[model samples]
Target: MKSPRVLLCVRQNTLRWDGEPSSLCCSSCCVLRCFDDRAAAARVNQHAHGRGTRTSLVRHGDPRVRLIAAHRSPLTALFSARGLQQITRQQQSPATQRRMRQQVSSEPQGVAEDILHLSAWLARQPHLPPVDDLLLDRFLYNCKYSLSRCKSVLDMYYTVRTAVPEFFKHRDATEDSIRRSCEVTLAAALPRLTPAGHRVFVHRLLDADSRRFDLLAHSRRVFMLVDVLLHTEPVLGAVVVLDLHASTWAHVLRAPPPLLRRLAVCFQDSCPIAIKEIHFVNAPGFIRKFLDIIRPLLKKKLNERVHVHTGGLETVGKSLPLHMLPKEYGGEEKSLKELSDAWQLALERRRDWFKAEELKRVDESLRPGAAPERAQLFGVEGSFQRLAVD
Candidate 1:
């Protein structure tokens, strides 16, 4: 006795519905069609036996016939007509192509290619730590994509991290003291951007108590914020708004000159982001004395960008958009207290990630390049000029 035959439809790009061959035009197209009826099987066999049509006959006991009715994979459908048309328009538009090319060219030359080349270059040199694509990209960006400049900055960045143990070492955000300092410092990156596309970062001394203000902890918090921005925000530069309104003389006195100098050098030389401007708002009279102490340490260009405004919020408004500032600065935005509370919660959420970063550091002995001479790189020790106390 012969086994019963099953009729199956195998038309290309055609659908099947209700045991009938159907075109894709139908809104309810079935992906697969199979028939076990003897009459339907006999009809399909007669027409498709020698016509080379997609119809196929299978024995009733064949396991393969049972699998024929399964739905077709959605991945087989590449794109819709509308999607293809949109892609065609984008490719045809000269203005769109030109704008895209310009944006790509603005980045370091061969950004993707350089990542591979730099990785290989670092591997050949002894004593260098393994280079990751993300870190290399940051170095390239900070150096304006110049390969040589990128290499130089990379060296300096790790060197500074190793040299300044006070600022970078043992910086676990989970510790009680460090967490308390982060809350008191109230350093945060604002959601708003400057008119020129620079991200706005505001730092204020929320706690006037000198005991709570640890310069090292404050530096760690600032670096943590910078790390967050580097990965998340896409901006050309940064505008730092330093609100010294609540800062007291005790806080200033606790910030030693040497520590301040190290912080300045790290930002000026090692950091991979451009500091567009540093707005010192609500500054005190004695602030100038402190500024005078560090003025010589700063590069001439950076010093020019530093604006000291003592005329209250009105003076700061002249340089920045008042509408973007917090309510304390006469802006319509959220109050400083509200922003600070929200930021504190954000930091708490990332505590574990920050802790992991604290354990990772560069081994100076492994550097194939010349080790950074701390005295020559930072400056002569005890050479800092004393500031006038009166």
Candidate 2:
């Protein structure tokens, strides 16, 4: 009697439906109900048929010859124990445990490599000041915080650790050591503010094999560095201003608004970067929240004694909108030239606006809801205009 022909069907990118058999196989006694590929039969016959070619083949089913679906294929299960067992007899032996350990040991170091790569890229920037090792440490500490809070980050940290050198064992080194390494790398590198340069560097760092570990760390560090340098480096001030104008900080502060506000003023009077331009794009709503917290502080006139050494356009642009003040305060908006002219007129009158009753009243106005808001109304408006125009 002639035996029934058998065929095995394979799925391509199709989802395996529930209760539907994901695989097909043929046996000597049973026929496949719905397989697609008959082409495989020739190969199977050539490979497995042992009976005389002339004789009728029996349709007995062989459990070993079952068809495995793509999802269940040995290749698909490459990471499974059965697949790994086929690698080498040595791997099958006790050596497998050691191999696993070796893999585990290198991940943290790999993470370190990614951190170093990012630091190196940032160091190459022309507009940024030379970052010190301590700064890098701060960056790494931020990474650690991210890892502690996010599982995905922890996975990246481990993957990087696995690629590290033998001497840099994760078990042997503490978080502080890695942090120090980060700081050292940053300290050794210089900052560059060219948009083209920064974008290129950012791309490279993110392309790293296990990039996520240091993502938040890098973003926060770069933004903070830029923010600080804006208040300090006069030469790079214009570029930072341009960036603030073109970009927003929305990308970095994915967390709550309160936290974002705290970060904005966390440096406190330590305006390391020149304050020519401030943008809210990177962290949308960040600047407004910052202003809210700072309004009361400004009303206190704490910065009154502080000499804000603003130069260039900022110095020339220091004018408050009069309308921004309440009607009772005799406030009116004035142009840059007008503000400058007003200041000059005040000088001619020998009336120091800084010491005038208006200034004192504004200072005293810092006490209650109505008056306090006015003290800030002037500076906040000024800061916003400067940031916006920059």
lDDT per model, in order?
A: 0.58, 0.26
Q: Give the least accurate 10-residue stretch of model 1, judged by summed lDDT.
A: 83-92
**Clashing pairs for predicted structure model 1, backbone only:** 127-366, 127-367
Q: Taking the tens digit of each residue's C-alpha lDDT, what string does model 1 give over 297-355? A: 78788899888887554466544678767777777667666765555555555667667
For this target, which candidate reaches the highest lDDT against the unseen true structure? 1
- How many clashes (backbone N, Cα, C below 3 Å) per candidate? 2, 61
Looking at model 2, residue 281 earns an lDDT score of: 20
Predicted structure 2, TM vs. truth: 0.18
lDDT score, residue 176, model 2?
Answer: 45
Candidate 1 has an lDDT of 0.58
Per-residue lDDT tens digits for candidate 2, residues 129-211, read 34433233323332332322222222222222222112112211123443332332121011222221110011111121232
Poorest stretch of ten by lDDT in candidate 2: 196-205
Stretches off by above 4 angstroms in model 2 are 1-216, 223-253, 279-390
Using all chains and alpha carbons, the TM-scores for the candidates as numbered come to: 0.67, 0.18
User: Which model scores highest in TM-score?
Assistant: 1
